[model samples]
Every structure is written in C-alpha cells, then in structure tokens.
Target: MSLSTKSPKTSPIKIMQNRIYELLKQGKRIDGRAPHEVRPVSISTSVIEKADGSAMVSMGGTKILTGIKVETGTPYSDRPNEGVFTVNAELLPLASASFEPGPPDERAVELARIVDRCIRESRAIDLEKLVITEGEKVYMLYIDIYVLDYDGNYFDPAVLSAVAALATCKIPRYEMRNGKLERVEGESMKTPIRTIPVSVMIGVIQDRLLVDPSPMEERALDTSVILGYDSDSNIVSIQKNTPGLLSLNMMEQIIELGSKKAEELRSILVEAVGLGS
Candidate 1:
C-alpha cells in the first residue's frame, strides 16, 4: 500500500476545513484590520437646492442623503406646547440589489425609528421653542432620509446625515399678524435646535469587533450594535441586533470606541452646519 493513501480524497478535507472555519474563533480578519477600524467617511451639507436643509454622508459603499423641511402647523393636542417632528426613511432600489421598489419596508421603519429617537430623546432640537402658540401655532420639522447606496451600517451614516441636514437647514421666518402669518425674508435664521446627536454601528464577529463594517462583513457578523451619542458624548440611544450575547467588558470596549467615533463625526456635522470655527 502506498505510504500516503491518496490523501483520503481532498473533497472531504475541503468540507472539513470549511466546517472548522465556521466553528473556530479566528484571530483576525482577512482585511488585516483590528475589527474596530471605521471606514473613511465623507459628508457634505446643503446639497439639495429645493430642500430647506440637506446633507449627504458616504461611508465606504454606503451613501445616505437627508433633507429637512420645516413648516408652520398646529400643535398636537397631547403636547400643546411642543412642535411636531416626523421622520421618514426610504431605501431606493438603486441603492442595492436587495432593496425593492415600493413603499417603506420594515428596515426603513426601523431606520427611521432609530434616527428619530436619537434626535428626539437627545433634545437635539428644542421642541418647546418651536411652539409659537399654546395649541394653535407650531413648527413642524419633517426629516426625509434616502439610502442612495447600501453597503451596510446604514443607521449610523443615516443619522449623521439627518443631523447635519437639520443643522444646516434654514426655516422661513414668519411673522404672525392678526392671526395671519407673513413670510419674512432678508437674512437667514437657524432652526430651534439645542444639540446634535451622532450615531455609530459596531459589528461583532467571533472575538473581533468591527466598526463601520462593509456589506460582506455585515452579512457575516454574529451581532451588530448601534450607539447614538450626543454633543456631550452622552449615550442617547442604543439598539442591538442579533441574539448573541456579549460580555460586560466587550460592551465597555465598544462604548469607548463608539464615543470617540461619535465626537469625530459630530465635529464633521458642526463644520457642515457652519457652527465650527
């Protein structure tokens, strides 16, 4: 008999190798990244001429555009002293192969909810100030987010774009005269916003944690978490994906990394809004 018995067929070995990879905890990823490296981000604001406020943010292959349109309206009955704020998100089919053309899906709804919570709960915009009257008059802020491209990690970039768009947005000045409103034009004015909230996503694969993972990385991830941070670097909102459990130490590490990323992103938003010197 031959000393090497035909290597026992390479096909079975290949299958075993694949199973080992799936079961084992690899040391590092193929990209040679530490799993915490965020992709290069590019952001710009006031891109849409028709929108009162608009911004676009691109991270790797993911691209998001956000626009804010503010108008006068009546306040809600429950919150008589608060203005109205609404968020709508769209995943255009052009963005990715998976996105279909139609009304918003569950993904879109989730995106909108995350971004909306980050802003509303963070007190980024002063809603009480938006109320012009007890219940009759108030300002309505409508934020529209468009996913022009999808590579993964859509929540962070979308929220960032929304914040930048709202920061750069200029609402028309209206003066109330005898229960009538007149548009005031001359110089521009700022919206009634108090702070800015930034969002970042972290991907966990085995022992590695990746920040701003690409589509492939996202697909292979065991879990993904999103953390929304305010200008003060305070946690505004946290959304977790996947049922996989993480240790407290891992959570702390991710928090530190996310906070750093959020501050950097917030600076970008400030610059886009002309708030940064």
Candidate 2:
C-alpha cells in the first residue's frame, strides 16, 4: 500500500455532516436540539495581554477572540466633538477550512460592519465624553475580532464577543494642561457608553424559519436575516443579503422572536460584564 493511502480504520467527518443534513430535512437534529435553540455559550474576558480590553466567546464548538484598543485623536470633521469607532474582523485559517489567511474577506467585512453599525449607529457610546478638547482631542476605538474556531453561526458570537470586550474596555486617562497632553497609566477607567444592542440571526429554509442555525443548516437555508435590537427590545437595524422575499407577517414574527431572544442574550452579557442592571 502506498504511504499516502488511508488506513482501513479511518473516520469520515463529511459523511456525518451529510447525515445531519438529512436528519434536519426530516425535521430533526442529531443532538436533539430544537431548530431554534442556540448552542451553549461560554464567555470570558481580559484574555489578551496587550490589548486595552479583550474577550473570548465560545458558542458550542466555535470560539472567537475580540480585543478593543482606544487611542486619542482628532474627531472627524463631520462630527467634530464626537469620537470614532471602527471594527475589523479576521477569520484565521485555523478557524475553518473556508477561510484563508489574508485581509478581511467580504464575509468578514460584512460581519464587522453589522456589528459596528449596531453599536455605532445606535448611539450606544457617549462620543461627546470621548472629546478631551473641543475639536482638538478625541478617542478612537478599534475593535479587532479573530475567529479561533468554527462551529456554526459565527455572526452572533462575534457580536457578543465584541460587546463583551467593549463592556470591559478601559479608556486611557488623559488630561490637557496648558495645551499639553498627558497620559495616565494604570489609572484609566471604563469607557462611557449608553444603550446596549444585541444581534440575533434567523435562517429561512423553504417555508420554515429557524434561529441559531448550525453550519449545515446555514448552507441549506434560502437566506438569512440579522436583526439588531436594543435593551428595550426596540429594533435598531436589519440586514438581509439573500435574494429571498419576506412577507410582513413573517417579518413581524421574526422581530418578536429576535426581540425576546435579544433580551435573554442581554442578560447573559450583563452577567458576564457584572453590570448592576
């Protein structure tokens, strides 16, 4: 036998994936989880030694690492007194076979945009507070997300990871005296923030819609919808990229589901961040 030949006792992961897909067609899952039930999620914070703030979120077998870095800079001309926030996502090759090593691909860019928009456009951060000087000094927040593992439904996990990191993030203490800037080390405090936004995705396959779909379920779906909700369960943003039509009734149903689930997920984030409310 050739050295490259496989042994008789070989395991086939693809076969199992196909089997799971077939079972899903029969309205069942191999793990007995309901179609809408999300996998178990575990979250940890302050993992990166260098970043100002960091977090690691694991949803089932998927793992994502997020870091937040805050720097002082001049505010954008359009928003003189307001600070700026930017999000970047990197899906390393180690995370999954589909991802490659390079700059952010379209999927990663879309993911970052969705997460950034939900927070930035929702007026969650107190950008005015970030202004150390009127149109002179402002804070710039850079959020980086690295996917360490791949299971399924990476979008939700990535958002949660970003938020967790942000909640624990600390802004460097700076003071301007006589037009001179000074940085205070180990004396920084939490960044001023406002509302909390949560993102939830639903998959539409044929006539049925499912929440928290696995990788296989995602591949089988006609399209997917990502709904972002605020702490008050108000819809903030909606992004749909698939060529599928959604009825008003279906949209209503998804909104209700997404709102309810967002509240549930917010509780998890609150506990992770040790918030009073």
Candidate 3:
C-alpha cells in the first residue's frame, strides 16, 4: 500500500504573511511605500486654548494629541533643584475597537513611558530652569497624551505631539509672596528647550524590515524596534517590542535608518514650531 504524502494546508493568515514577506523582499510595502519610507505626517499646535500648550499630530491614519499643564509643586527629594515632569497617555476606545474604556492598560502605560524616556533621556527640556525656588517649590509639567486614532504606530506621533506641544508651551510665571508661590497674572514664558527628540519605529518580519508599518503590517510583524534620537543624532532611548532576536547586521541597519528618519521628522517638528532648522 502506498502511503499518503499530502502536505498540511496553509491558513489565510499564513498566506497573507507570505505575501507581505514577498513584497518586502522587493523593497516594497503593501501600502506602496519603500522599505525606508515613512507615512505622510501633519502637525498642528495650540489646538486647545485652555491648555497651557497643545499639539495635534497626524501620521497616516494615526492621530495623537498632547496637552501640557503647568503647576507649582515641591521638587523631588533626589533632585530638589530640578522641576518635576510627568507623562500620561490615554488610549481612547473610539481610537480602536480593541481599546476598552477603563483605566490605562499596559499599552497605554507603555506608550507614556516610552515617550517619557525619549524626552527625559534626551534632556529636551531644561528642568533646572523650571525651578521657582531651590528645594522648596518648582514648576511641575504634566504632559497628557490622547490617542484619538489608531493606525499602527502610536509612539512616533505621540512623541512628536508631546515635543511640539512642549516646544510651543507657555509656562505661567509665579512668584514667592509671603512664603507662598503666587501665580503672576498675565505673565508667561516659553519652556527652556535644550534639544528636540524624535523617534523612528522599524518593524521586522522574517528577514524584511519596514519603516512606519501600518495596522495590517503591524499584525504581520514578528517584532519591532523604536529608537529615539536627539538633535545631535545621539541615541537617547531604545525600545524593542515583542519577542524576536535581531541579527547584528539588522541592528546596524536599524540604527542607520533610525538616525536618518529621525532627522527628517525633527525638521518637520522644527518647522511647525517656527524653530530655525
């Protein structure tokens, strides 16, 4: 008797994955973009008049808005001379069906932390300058990020929005009166900006790499890497999502691509804020 030698059937998901891999082999993406091409980006600032500072960023289908609120608070014990800065992110249910209405989930927390690291590590803001009084009272900046739309990549746009909002932020002046911190009426000043930080995300599938992967590509990706670069082209922060091992050559490629893409994104932010490039 002859034994059956039929191979297992291929699932639709596998077929789609194969298609993506094949396209990437030709340096093309399903979205008709080159391997190193980022989606179209649009940025606007001062969207919210009530907020101290606000910015909205749209990258492809992804949309993110960031607002800044300045208040007086005691400095941290470890860094009494430096002001306090915090980042919070909210992934609204309207942004995506997968998101649920409740407290911040892991994804939201991760998004906030990544953006925070990018800014904090890059030293984009001069925290020392925000101090109102040494070891007593200082300016506390609250950066709130809202994900209004979900495409694939939220990190890049969220960072961009936060940076833009900060770049155009106006901190209300305060003074010490009767040993109390009093807000100076009709007085405000811009935040002391030291440098701008831009992040680039690269998705990897098999041996292929894609820049700014869309929602569909994100699902097909095996892993992804996000690198944040400062104005000096120095890598300030790096985060790798999902579980996958990258070869040495792929790491080198990602670093090179990330630096180039970061510069492009930084120029857009600078222009939006009227900062000379």
Candidate 4:
C-alpha cells in the first residue's frame, strides 16, 4: 500500500528492462520505435460537460485526462492583479495496480508540481485578465489531472493535457453584484493566453537516449529529464529526476533533442485547440 515503495510487479519489469537494454544497444526499441521517436499522439477536447473545460490525451499506451475549473476567490495580497492557478494530479487505482485509493502520494504531488511549474512559470495564461476586482476578487484556475493509464513518462503527457484543457477553456463572466462576485449568464470569453508551452521527457540509459520510454524502460534507465519550452524554443522549465551525474555535453544533447520533439508536439496541440466545439 505504500506508494513510495517499488512494487513487486517490478520483478516482471526487470525482464522487460533487460530486453529493452538489449534492443537499445542495437539502436532500436522494443516497440520498433527509433531512439528519439515518440509514440503516436492523439487528443480530444471538452471531454467533461460539468467542467468548464476538459481534455484527454493518449500517447501510445499512456492516457491522461485534464479538467479546467475556474473559481471566483480573493487574490493573493502581493499578487492582487493576477489570478491563481493550482494543478492537482490523481493517480487513479484503475489506472494501475500500484496506485492506491487515498490521498495523492509523493508521485502524484511531484507530477502536479512539475506540470504547474511548466505552465505557470512559462506565463502561458494571462492571469491579469482573470482578476475581477483589485485585491478583492479574481478567477482562479483549478487544473485536475487524472492518470488513467500510466505506461511511462507521466510528465510530458500531464503537461499536454493541462495545456490543451487551458487552451480550450472558456472564461466565464462575473461581476461585483450586491458586494459579491456573481456569474453573468450567457456571457463567456475565451481564456486569455500569452504563450503556449510544450514539454518533452526523455530517459537516458547508458549511451541510449530514448523519448517516451515505456514503464519497463524507465525502471532500467540511469536518469531522466523533463523539460518545457515556449513557442520560440526558449527553455521554460527543467526537472532532472533521480540522482545521477550527467555530462554537460549530454545535457546539451538532451536539450536539443527535447526542443525539437516539443515543436513537433506543439503542432498537434495547435490543431486540436483550434477546433470548434
């Protein structure tokens, strides 16, 4: 039941790991993907009617769902003019056997925080427009991420879902009525966005650099990286998981590899977000 402990299921993964390592040595992957090739990407928007916005993304075997909810609340004292954004991730037990039925464990929390850093720090949303009243009322974005299928590399897929949900989110109209903020019927605006950020994660095992590694492959990797980029190819955020020494040259290579992959993924999002629901 302990989320932090490695599951006994890992024993089966060990065999897979050895198989993948052998394949990597031959410049290939078990699934017949190139070392830097990512799996197929597909997305669907407005998946939930109750939420303001929702999106589902599937990357090969991994499936993730994200919902966007805008709430009216007081703004932070220091950031009176800006809205607030919180990202919450849930590892549903149905998604995998290792997941438990309780509060999010460390894995879930870390996934949420990393996705939050990628979106929030990238300044993807125009938070100022979310403010209804100075220091009094502001619209806050609640991003709920559900891991329906965690095959591998939750970081990148989580980011994809969040961005898609946000891009398709409708900003509801609210006003100060009777000294309280109330929603205005039949008045909704598009979510104000400043930039689009895309994230790419790759696992490094020995001399192999693999994009979108499978769960088995991740278990055998020496290290991994999750990096975010804006439309202009600027690095927005970066997270290096586990403790391992990486050469500067290797890091640079990974950055270049990640940046290219992010651009490819961005196009998919752009097309999906442009659709009319």
Model 1 accuracy (lDDT, Cα): 0.79
Better of 1 and 3 by lDDT: 3
Clashes within 3 Å, all models in order: 1, 0, 0, 0
Quote model 4's TM-score. 0.93
* Model 2: colliding residue pairs: none
Off by over 4 Å in 1: 1-33, 186-188
Candidate closer to the true structure by TM-score (higher is better), 1 or 2:
2
Task: Please report the TM-score between candidate 1 and the true structure.
Answer: 0.86
Model 2 segments more than 4 A misplaced: 1-27
Per-residue alpha-carbon lDDT of candidate 3 for residues 1-277, written as tens digits (9 for 90 to 100): 1011111321226666788889999988887999889999999999999999999999998999999999999999999999999999999988877677999999899999999999999999999999999999999999999999888799999999999999999999999999987989999999899999999999988777888987767767888999999999999999997676766678888898899999999999999998764
Clashing pairs in 1: 35-210
Q: Relative to the unseen true structure, what is the C-alpha lDDT of residue 177 in candidate 4, on a scale of 0 to 100? A: 91
Best by TM-score: 3
Clashing pairs in 3: none
lDDT of 3: 0.89
**Highest lDDT: which candidate?**
3
Task: Report the lDDT of model 2 for residue 2.
Answer: 17
Q: After superposition, how far is residue 52 of candidate 4 from its true place, in Å?
A: 0.2
What TM-score goes with each of the models? Answer: 0.86, 0.89, 0.94, 0.93
Candidate 2 clash figure, as a count: 0
lDDT of 1 at 234: 90
The lDDT values for all models are 0.79, 0.79, 0.89, 0.86
